[model samples]
Target: MSVHRSALCRGPYGGEGAAAGGTGCSDPAIFEVARHGRPPLPVCPVHLGPALLMASGVLWPPEIRLIGRVTGLRP
Candidate 1:
């Protein structure tokens, strides 16, 4: 069995692990983790979370936060 980040890393803009030490899909912390290693994350700098960073009292480059959600279909 294998676990891909695409699965583990997909969710709303605040998903946990999204940032290095974040607590949601869109956590800036997850970006830090994705910055390295195989299957590099294709995160757009422009879509980075500025509001989140500000609320968290963290700083980052100028950009917009592109938010989305990953959901499973049920039959």
Candidate 2:
């Protein structure tokens, strides 16, 4: 059972309700695969610039997602 907690991936599909806290957190927390935890939004703070302007106030697609060992930022 893969959990979304916000499950806010880079695509436009899964972020809606989870980002709005329906799944658990409007501001979901980011965790290492098993190491540490941080707030998910700031995890990809630079990526969130557009999200800030999106007027939707979703909780992800942020720069904090790029931190440490995330996969979406890679080529």
Candidate 3:
């Protein structure tokens, strides 16, 4: 699958313990994550951990899977 590196990380951020204001991470995306039949989301390494944790809580059996890697992208 073709992956876009231009998209910024879509992982939610800026909560009680995180820096406030921003709703998601600003880092460039490194992986394209697919959530079952839902549209894929771009996520960076920095937020991947938190994203997974959040997903595990929301979905009974987390359906999030790595579908593609953004070429030439690094954390």
Predicted structure with the largest TM-score when compared to the true one? 3
Cα-based TM-score, every candidate = 0.18, 0.22, 0.52
Write the residue-wise lDDT of candidate 1 on 1-75 in tens digits: 122333333212323353532224442222321221222232323324443343332223422323333234375
* Steric collisions counted per model: 16, 11, 0
User: For candidate 2, lDDT tens digit of each residue in 1-75?
Assistant: 135444432322123344533223233333311112322333123334433444233444433233333445557
> In candidate 3, what are the lDDT values of residues 1-75, reduced to their tens digit?
344646667764323335332355677766545554445555677666666665323343444455446456477
- Candidate 1 has its poorest 10 consecutive residues by lDDT at 27-36
Judging by TM-score, tell me the better candidate of 1 and 3. Answer: 3
Whole-structure CA lDDT of model 3: 0.53
**Residue 21 miss distance in model 3 (angstroms):** 11
- Local distance difference test values of all predictions, in order: 0.30, 0.32, 0.53
How much lDDT does candidate 2 score?
Answer: 0.32
Ranking by lDDT: 3, 2, 1
